[model samples]
Target: MADEEYISVEEVASIMGLSVRQASRYAAKVRTERINQRVLFHRDDVMEQARLKGIEHEARERAATYQPKPTKTDLVPAGEMLEYIRERDRQLAEVQAQLNQALLEIGRLQGQLTDHQQIRQQLTDIQSERDELKQAMERARPWWRRILGHD
Candidate 1:
């Protein structure tokens, strides 16, 4: 409050690990400023809140570099990974080929089905025509032939 310097809620949220809305709520009792629609609080007030929440502002220096000791089972060898990928790819290719063949077979079967349907329709038409012709012939027979049961 003495310095009158204001920090944006975004900085407070980053330092405190709280959301902007939460930081704004924490800064409610502090002096605030609005610049370009950003809610800002006095820098000292933000630091005071952080201190009261038991969060120290000090950065600890690491004494030594970190070395990971992962077990052998944790990592896969590059050669084995490559071989597995190749096998998966081979299986996928075989499946794709089979799928293509199946699609072709389906298309051929559909064509055959269409041909059979057309043949059935043609046979029906021919049978209907034959029946009509036989009826016409019966009508053309003379009365004497009809009485004698001759054609």
Candidate 2:
């Protein structure tokens, strides 16, 4: 077989049917370190290690029973907390400003809609007044003339 190059921890896990953490531990046992936070393993080294560890039933059993411990870090200082709060407040203020602008635009549009409605109502009133004027003019005409005008 040809010499294989480097492979990622996830790739190794897929090949060995193991989890990424298990692959990481295997890589670490072989003194394989990550480069720039990217974990890579030599395929030959990984396969050799897997073959050697394959017959070790005790190691496999231990690995299956292993559990990672949780870590606790110190909380942020009061000053740092205040700074975070200030940053959050600034972001909220910016969002509120945008919301206010949107509301103002909505109000302007509503006013424009009201103006259009008022214009439409005025047009309807004008048409009614024109109709009434026509009716009044017809009524004021003499009855004999009105009868002849239609002919």
Where model 1 places Cα greater than 4 Å from the true spot, the runs are 1-76
Models, CA RMSD each? 10.7, 12.7
Model 2 worst lDDT run, 10 consecutive residues: 65-74
List, residue by residue over 1-151, the lDDT tens digit for candidate 1: 3434776676666666677788779667777887788777876676677677777353001102213345586688879989999999999999999999999999999999999999999999999999999989988999899899986
lDDT digits (tens) for residues 1-151 of candidate 2:
2223676676667556678887788766654546788867776676667678683454344435544333333366778889999999999999999999999999999999999999999999999999999999999988988999962
- State each model's CA lDDT, in order: 0.74, 0.73
Candidate with top lDDT is: 1
Worst 10 residues of 1 by lDDT: 58-67
- Scored by lDDT, model 2 comes in at 0.73
